[model samples]
Target: MILGFGMDVVEIARMARILAGPPARAERFLARVFTPAERAYCDARQDRAGRYAARFAAKEAAVKALGAPAGVRWSELEVIRAEGAPSLTLAGAAAAAGARLGVARVFLTITHDAGVAAAAVILEGAQR
Candidate 1:
Protein backbone atom coordinates (compact mmCIF):
# COMPACT_ATOMS: atom_id res chain seq x y z
CA MET A 1 0.00 0.00 0.00
CA ILE A 2 1.09 3.59 -0.54
CA LEU A 3 1.00 6.20 2.19
CA GLY A 4 2.09 9.25 0.25
CA PHE A 5 3.25 10.52 -3.12
CA GLY A 6 5.24 13.57 -4.22
CA MET A 7 6.88 15.01 -7.26
CA ASP A 8 9.20 17.90 -8.14
CA VAL A 9 10.59 19.60 -11.21
CA VAL A 10 13.67 21.82 -11.55
CA GLU A 11 15.02 23.85 -14.37
CA ILE A 12 18.34 22.46 -15.55
CA ALA A 13 19.43 26.04 -16.14
CA ARG A 14 19.14 26.82 -12.45
CA MET A 15 21.56 24.07 -11.56
CA ALA A 16 23.71 25.03 -14.51
CA ARG A 17 24.00 28.50 -13.10
CA ILE A 18 25.15 27.16 -9.78
CA LEU A 19 27.66 24.85 -11.43
CA ALA A 20 28.94 27.74 -13.48
CA GLY A 21 29.85 29.74 -10.41
CA PRO A 22 33.40 30.06 -9.14
CA PRO A 23 34.87 26.76 -8.01
CA ALA A 24 34.55 27.44 -4.29
CA ARG A 25 31.06 28.86 -4.66
CA ALA A 26 29.84 25.90 -6.65
CA GLU A 27 31.50 23.48 -4.27
CA ARG A 28 29.80 25.16 -1.33
CA PHE A 29 26.36 24.79 -2.91
CA LEU A 30 27.00 21.22 -3.97
CA ALA A 31 28.46 20.24 -0.62
CA ARG A 32 25.53 21.70 1.25
CA VAL A 33 22.92 20.08 -0.97
CA PHE A 34 24.25 16.70 -2.07
CA THR A 35 25.97 13.76 -0.43
CA PRO A 36 29.49 12.84 -1.49
CA ALA A 37 28.25 9.90 -3.55
CA GLU A 38 25.75 12.07 -5.37
CA ARG A 39 28.38 14.70 -6.10
CA ALA A 40 30.79 12.09 -7.38
CA TYR A 41 28.17 10.47 -9.57
CA CYS A 42 26.94 13.72 -11.10
CA ASP A 43 30.43 15.14 -11.52
CA ALA A 44 31.44 12.12 -13.56
CA ARG A 45 28.58 12.57 -15.98
CA GLN A 46 28.71 14.78 -19.06
CA ASP A 47 25.39 16.44 -18.23
CA ARG A 48 26.60 17.31 -14.75
CA ALA A 49 24.13 20.12 -14.12
CA GLY A 50 21.21 18.06 -15.32
CA ARG A 51 22.28 15.19 -13.09
CA TYR A 52 22.56 17.49 -10.13
CA ALA A 53 19.19 19.00 -10.86
CA ALA A 54 17.61 15.57 -10.99
CA ARG A 55 19.09 14.70 -7.62
CA PHE A 56 17.89 17.97 -6.20
CA ALA A 57 14.39 17.23 -7.39
CA ALA A 58 14.64 13.78 -5.90
CA LYS A 59 15.55 15.19 -2.51
CA GLU A 60 12.63 17.60 -2.60
CA ALA A 61 10.26 14.88 -3.75
CA ALA A 62 11.37 12.61 -0.95
CA VAL A 63 10.73 15.30 1.62
CA LYS A 64 7.29 15.92 0.19
CA ALA A 65 6.64 12.19 0.23
CA LEU A 66 7.24 12.29 3.96
CA GLY A 67 4.72 15.10 4.28
CA ALA A 68 7.38 17.79 4.74
CA PRO A 69 8.71 16.64 8.07
CA ALA A 70 10.62 19.44 9.77
CA GLY A 71 13.49 17.27 10.96
CA VAL A 72 14.55 16.20 7.50
CA ARG A 73 17.64 17.93 6.16
CA TRP A 74 18.70 18.22 2.56
CA SER A 75 21.78 16.06 2.97
CA GLU A 76 19.99 13.58 5.18
CA LEU A 77 17.96 12.42 2.21
CA GLU A 78 20.32 10.88 -0.31
CA VAL A 79 19.69 10.15 -3.97
CA ILE A 80 21.74 7.23 -5.16
CA ARG A 81 22.15 4.85 -8.04
CA ALA A 82 21.63 1.19 -7.34
CA GLU A 83 21.84 -1.22 -10.27
CA GLY A 84 21.98 1.71 -12.69
CA ALA A 85 18.65 3.15 -11.53
CA PRO A 86 17.83 5.99 -9.21
CA SER A 87 17.23 5.06 -5.59
CA LEU A 88 16.86 6.99 -2.32
CA THR A 89 17.72 6.41 1.30
CA LEU A 90 16.67 8.44 4.30
CA ALA A 91 19.22 8.91 7.05
CA GLY A 92 19.53 10.70 10.37
CA ALA A 93 16.49 12.83 11.16
CA ALA A 94 15.05 11.91 7.80
CA ALA A 95 15.05 8.24 8.72
CA ALA A 96 13.45 8.96 12.05
CA ALA A 97 10.73 10.96 10.37
CA GLY A 98 10.10 8.25 7.83
CA ALA A 99 9.74 5.71 10.58
CA ARG A 100 7.32 7.89 12.45
CA LEU A 101 5.27 8.31 9.32
CA GLY A 102 5.14 4.57 8.61
CA VAL A 103 7.22 4.72 5.48
CA ALA A 104 8.08 1.09 4.90
CA ARG A 105 9.61 1.60 1.47
CA VAL A 106 10.69 4.53 -0.67
CA PHE A 107 10.32 4.43 -4.41
CA LEU A 108 12.17 6.98 -6.54
CA THR A 109 12.48 7.83 -10.18
CA ILE A 110 14.22 10.80 -11.89
CA THR A 111 14.50 12.11 -15.40
CA HIS A 112 15.97 15.02 -17.36
CA ASP A 113 14.82 16.43 -20.65
CA ALA A 114 14.70 19.69 -22.60
CA GLY A 115 16.50 21.66 -19.89
CA VAL A 116 14.33 20.33 -17.11
CA ALA A 117 14.83 17.74 -14.43
CA ALA A 118 12.10 16.00 -12.51
CA ALA A 119 11.57 13.33 -9.86
CA ALA A 120 8.78 11.39 -8.22
CA VAL A 121 8.64 9.51 -4.94
CA ILE A 122 6.15 7.00 -3.62
CA LEU A 123 6.01 6.16 0.05
CA GLU A 124 4.77 2.65 0.55
CA GLY A 125 3.70 1.13 3.80
CA ALA A 126 0.76 0.16 5.97
CA GLN A 127 -1.72 2.88 5.25
CA ARG A 128 -2.52 5.19 8.08
Candidate 2:
Protein backbone atom coordinates (compact mmCIF):
# COMPACT_ATOMS: atom_id res chain seq x y z
CA MET A 1 0.00 0.00 0.00
CA ILE A 2 1.09 3.52 -0.71
CA LEU A 3 1.52 5.72 2.32
CA GLY A 4 2.57 8.91 0.56
CA PHE A 5 4.36 10.36 -2.48
CA GLY A 6 6.48 13.41 -3.29
CA MET A 7 8.62 14.99 -5.96
CA ASP A 8 11.20 17.78 -6.11
CA VAL A 9 13.47 19.59 -8.53
CA VAL A 10 16.68 21.57 -8.15
CA GLU A 11 18.69 23.88 -10.33
CA ILE A 12 22.14 22.56 -11.11
CA ALA A 13 23.65 26.02 -11.41
CA ARG A 14 22.39 27.03 -7.99
CA MET A 15 23.86 23.96 -6.41
CA ALA A 16 27.09 24.53 -8.29
CA ARG A 17 27.40 28.05 -6.99
CA ILE A 18 26.95 26.94 -3.42
CA LEU A 19 29.50 24.19 -3.88
CA ALA A 20 31.96 26.60 -5.46
CA GLY A 21 31.76 29.23 -2.76
CA PRO A 22 34.38 29.95 -0.10
CA PRO A 23 36.04 26.77 1.11
CA ALA A 24 34.78 27.04 4.67
CA ARG A 25 31.26 27.99 3.63
CA ALA A 26 31.08 25.21 1.06
CA GLU A 27 32.29 22.64 3.56
CA ARG A 28 29.82 23.86 6.14
CA PHE A 29 26.96 23.75 3.69
CA LEU A 30 27.80 20.23 2.59
CA ALA A 31 28.39 18.97 6.10
CA ARG A 32 25.13 20.39 7.30
CA VAL A 33 22.95 19.02 4.50
CA PHE A 34 24.69 15.87 3.24
CA THR A 35 26.23 12.80 4.79
CA PRO A 36 29.93 12.02 4.38
CA ALA A 37 29.10 9.14 2.09
CA GLU A 38 26.94 11.36 -0.09
CA ARG A 39 29.68 13.97 -0.29
CA ALA A 40 32.20 11.32 -1.25
CA TYR A 41 29.89 9.90 -3.90
CA CYS A 42 29.22 13.27 -5.48
CA ASP A 43 32.80 14.47 -5.21
CA ALA A 44 34.06 11.36 -6.98
CA ARG A 45 31.98 12.20 -10.03
CA GLN A 46 33.10 14.59 -12.75
CA ASP A 47 29.69 16.24 -12.82
CA ARG A 48 29.61 16.92 -9.11
CA ALA A 49 26.99 19.65 -9.38
CA GLY A 50 24.52 17.38 -11.15
CA ARG A 51 25.13 14.53 -8.76
CA TYR A 52 24.76 16.74 -5.72
CA ALA A 53 21.67 18.40 -7.12
CA ALA A 54 20.03 15.03 -7.79
CA ARG A 55 20.79 13.79 -4.31
CA PHE A 56 19.52 17.01 -2.78
CA ALA A 57 16.30 16.68 -4.71
CA ALA A 58 15.99 13.08 -3.58
CA LYS A 59 16.33 14.10 0.06
CA GLU A 60 13.71 16.80 -0.30
CA ALA A 61 11.32 14.42 -2.04
CA ALA A 62 11.81 11.80 0.65
CA VAL A 63 11.08 14.31 3.39
CA LYS A 64 7.92 15.46 1.65
CA ALA A 65 6.76 11.88 1.14
CA LEU A 66 7.38 11.27 4.83
CA GLY A 67 5.00 14.13 5.67
CA ALA A 68 7.73 16.64 6.56
CA PRO A 69 8.14 15.13 9.99
CA ALA A 70 9.50 17.57 12.55
CA GLY A 71 13.13 17.40 13.69
CA VAL A 72 14.20 15.17 10.82
CA ARG A 73 17.75 15.92 9.78
CA TRP A 74 18.90 16.05 6.17
CA SER A 75 21.59 13.44 6.74
CA GLU A 76 18.94 11.00 7.90
CA LEU A 77 17.82 10.44 4.33
CA GLU A 78 20.73 8.99 2.39
CA VAL A 79 20.85 8.24 -1.30
CA ILE A 80 23.08 5.30 -2.04
CA ARG A 81 24.32 3.84 -5.29
CA ALA A 82 25.60 0.27 -5.35
CA GLU A 83 26.32 -1.75 -8.47
CA GLY A 84 24.83 1.10 -10.50
CA ALA A 85 21.46 0.81 -8.73
CA PRO A 86 20.29 3.74 -6.62
CA SER A 87 18.45 3.30 -3.33
CA LEU A 88 17.63 5.09 -0.07
CA THR A 89 18.82 4.33 3.46
CA LEU A 90 16.99 6.00 6.30
CA ALA A 91 18.47 6.60 9.73
CA GLY A 92 17.85 8.57 12.92
CA ALA A 93 14.70 10.65 12.71
CA ALA A 94 14.01 9.48 9.17
CA ALA A 95 13.79 5.86 10.29
CA ALA A 96 11.63 6.82 13.22
CA ALA A 97 9.26 8.66 10.92
CA GLY A 98 8.96 5.61 8.68
CA ALA A 99 8.17 3.40 11.65
CA ARG A 100 5.65 5.88 12.97
CA LEU A 101 3.91 6.00 9.59
CA GLY A 102 3.97 2.22 9.14
CA VAL A 103 6.06 2.57 6.01
CA ALA A 104 7.83 -0.61 5.02
CA ARG A 105 9.96 0.89 2.27
CA VAL A 106 10.53 3.97 0.17
CA PHE A 107 11.04 3.82 -3.57
CA LEU A 108 13.21 6.52 -5.14
CA THR A 109 13.95 7.71 -8.65
CA ILE A 110 16.29 10.55 -9.66
CA THR A 111 17.30 12.16 -12.92
CA HIS A 112 19.28 15.16 -14.15
CA ASP A 113 19.14 16.97 -17.47
CA ALA A 114 18.99 20.43 -18.97
CA GLY A 115 20.68 21.98 -15.95
CA VAL A 116 18.06 20.65 -13.59
CA ALA A 117 17.71 17.67 -11.29
CA ALA A 118 14.51 15.94 -10.31
CA ALA A 119 13.51 13.18 -7.92
CA ALA A 120 10.39 11.30 -6.94
CA VAL A 121 9.72 9.19 -3.87
CA ILE A 122 6.98 6.77 -2.93
CA LEU A 123 6.38 5.66 0.65
CA GLU A 124 5.07 2.12 0.79
CA GLY A 125 3.21 0.81 3.82
CA ALA A 126 3.41 -2.72 5.16
CA GLN A 127 0.62 -5.12 4.41
CA ARG A 128 -1.66 -5.76 7.31
Candidate 3:
Protein backbone atom coordinates (compact mmCIF):
# COMPACT_ATOMS: atom_id res chain seq x y z
CA MET A 1 0.00 0.00 0.00
CA ILE A 2 1.06 3.57 -0.55
CA LEU A 3 2.11 5.45 2.54
CA GLY A 4 3.11 8.91 1.27
CA PHE A 5 4.05 10.83 -1.86
CA GLY A 6 5.95 13.99 -2.93
CA MET A 7 7.29 15.88 -5.94
CA ASP A 8 9.29 19.04 -6.62
CA VAL A 9 11.07 21.14 -9.24
CA VAL A 10 13.81 23.72 -8.99
CA GLU A 11 15.50 26.25 -11.24
CA ILE A 12 19.19 25.66 -11.72
CA ALA A 13 19.98 29.37 -11.95
CA ARG A 14 18.42 30.19 -8.60
CA MET A 15 20.37 27.45 -6.93
CA ALA A 16 23.56 28.71 -8.54
CA ARG A 17 23.07 32.19 -7.12
CA ILE A 18 22.62 30.88 -3.62
CA LEU A 19 25.75 28.80 -3.87
CA ALA A 20 27.82 31.66 -5.27
CA GLY A 21 26.86 34.34 -2.76
CA PRO A 22 28.34 32.93 0.40
CA PRO A 23 30.44 29.92 1.17
CA ALA A 24 29.30 29.61 4.76
CA ARG A 25 25.65 29.88 3.84
CA ALA A 26 25.95 26.89 1.60
CA GLU A 27 27.69 24.98 4.33
CA ARG A 28 25.01 25.88 6.86
CA PHE A 29 22.20 25.02 4.51
CA LEU A 30 23.77 21.70 3.63
CA ALA A 31 24.36 20.88 7.26
CA ARG A 32 20.77 21.59 8.12
CA VAL A 33 19.19 19.80 5.19
CA PHE A 34 21.48 17.09 3.85
CA THR A 35 22.93 13.86 5.19
CA PRO A 36 26.70 13.42 5.47
CA ALA A 37 26.89 11.36 2.35
CA GLU A 38 24.70 13.74 0.43
CA ARG A 39 26.92 16.62 1.46
CA ALA A 40 29.98 14.74 0.44
CA TYR A 41 28.58 13.91 -2.94
CA CYS A 42 27.40 17.42 -3.64
CA ASP A 43 30.66 18.82 -2.43
CA ALA A 44 32.62 16.68 -4.82
CA ARG A 45 30.80 18.05 -7.84
CA GLN A 46 32.39 20.74 -9.99
CA ASP A 47 29.04 22.02 -11.11
CA ARG A 48 27.56 23.29 -7.86
CA ALA A 49 24.36 24.46 -9.51
CA GLY A 50 23.39 20.98 -10.50
CA ARG A 51 23.97 19.64 -7.05
CA TYR A 52 22.16 22.50 -5.31
CA ALA A 53 19.16 22.30 -7.61
CA ALA A 54 18.89 18.57 -7.11
CA ARG A 55 19.08 18.98 -3.36
CA PHE A 56 16.44 21.70 -3.36
CA ALA A 57 14.07 19.54 -5.32
CA ALA A 58 14.66 16.57 -3.05
CA LYS A 59 13.87 18.54 0.10
CA GLU A 60 10.68 19.94 -1.34
CA ALA A 61 9.61 16.53 -2.54
CA ALA A 62 10.23 14.98 0.85
CA VAL A 63 8.14 17.62 2.61
CA LYS A 64 5.30 17.15 0.17
CA ALA A 65 5.46 13.39 0.51
CA LEU A 66 5.25 13.71 4.27
CA GLY A 67 2.05 15.76 3.88
CA ALA A 68 2.97 17.77 6.99
CA PRO A 69 5.61 20.17 8.12
CA ALA A 70 8.80 18.53 9.19
CA GLY A 71 9.51 19.83 12.67
CA VAL A 72 11.71 22.92 12.26
CA ARG A 73 14.49 21.73 14.51
CA TRP A 74 15.40 18.70 12.51
CA SER A 75 17.11 18.70 9.19
CA GLU A 76 14.64 18.53 6.36
CA LEU A 77 14.27 15.21 4.60
CA GLU A 78 17.46 14.30 2.85
CA VAL A 79 18.19 12.21 -0.24
CA ILE A 80 21.40 10.33 -0.62
CA ARG A 81 22.80 7.53 -2.71
CA ALA A 82 24.16 4.14 -1.82
CA GLU A 83 25.89 2.07 -4.47
CA GLY A 84 24.59 4.67 -6.96
CA ALA A 85 20.98 4.11 -5.90
CA PRO A 86 18.86 6.71 -4.19
CA SER A 87 17.80 6.53 -0.52
CA LEU A 88 16.18 8.75 2.10
CA THR A 89 16.60 9.95 5.66
CA LEU A 90 13.87 11.95 7.37
CA ALA A 91 14.17 14.33 10.29
CA GLY A 92 11.86 16.55 12.37
CA ALA A 93 8.46 17.03 10.72
CA ALA A 94 9.25 14.62 7.97
CA ALA A 95 10.01 11.89 10.45
CA ALA A 96 6.82 12.63 12.38
CA ALA A 97 4.81 12.36 9.20
CA GLY A 98 6.42 9.06 8.33
CA ALA A 99 5.53 7.66 11.75
CA ARG A 100 1.99 8.94 11.50
CA LEU A 101 1.61 7.36 8.10
CA GLY A 102 3.13 4.07 9.32
CA VAL A 103 5.94 4.32 6.81
CA ALA A 104 8.94 2.06 7.23
CA ARG A 105 10.92 3.15 4.20
CA VAL A 106 11.04 5.97 1.65
CA PHE A 107 11.96 5.63 -1.98
CA LEU A 108 13.10 8.52 -4.09
CA THR A 109 14.34 9.38 -7.57
CA ILE A 110 15.81 12.63 -8.86
CA THR A 111 16.84 14.05 -12.18
CA HIS A 112 18.20 17.20 -13.75
CA ASP A 113 18.85 18.51 -17.22
CA ALA A 114 19.56 21.87 -18.79
CA GLY A 115 18.42 24.37 -16.14
CA VAL A 116 15.84 22.32 -14.29
CA ALA A 117 15.90 19.77 -11.55
CA ALA A 118 13.05 17.57 -10.38
CA ALA A 119 12.32 14.83 -7.88
CA ALA A 120 9.59 12.45 -6.76
CA VAL A 121 9.31 10.61 -3.46
CA ILE A 122 7.38 7.59 -2.30
CA LEU A 123 6.98 6.32 1.24
CA GLU A 124 6.41 2.64 1.85
CA GLY A 125 5.04 1.25 5.08
CA ALA A 126 5.79 -1.98 6.84
CA GLN A 127 3.46 -4.88 6.08
CA ARG A 128 0.42 -4.93 8.28
lDDT tens digits, residue span 29-103, model 1: 998899999988999999999999999999999888888988677999898786877789999988998888788
Worst 10 residues of 2 by lDDT: 81-90
Error of 2 at 21 (Å): 1.0
Best by lDDT: 2
Better of 1 and 2 by TM-score: 2
List runs of model 1 lying over 4 Å from the truth: none
Q: lDDT (0-100) at residue 88 of candidate 1?
A: 93
Instruction: State the lDDT of candidate 3 residue by residue for 41-100, as single tens digits.
Output: 887888767876887787788777777553633355667666876777877666777888
Error of 3 at 123 (Å): 1.1
Per-candidate TM-scores read: 0.94, 0.97, 0.84
In model 3, what are the clashing residue pairs, if there are any?
A: 5-65, 70-93, 70-94, 71-93
Q: What is the C-alpha lDDT of each candidate?
A: 0.91, 0.94, 0.77
The all-Cα superposition gives candidate 1 an RMSD in Å to the true structure of 1.4
RMSD of each: 1.4, 0.8, 2.2
Residue pairs whose backbone atoms clash in candidate 1: none
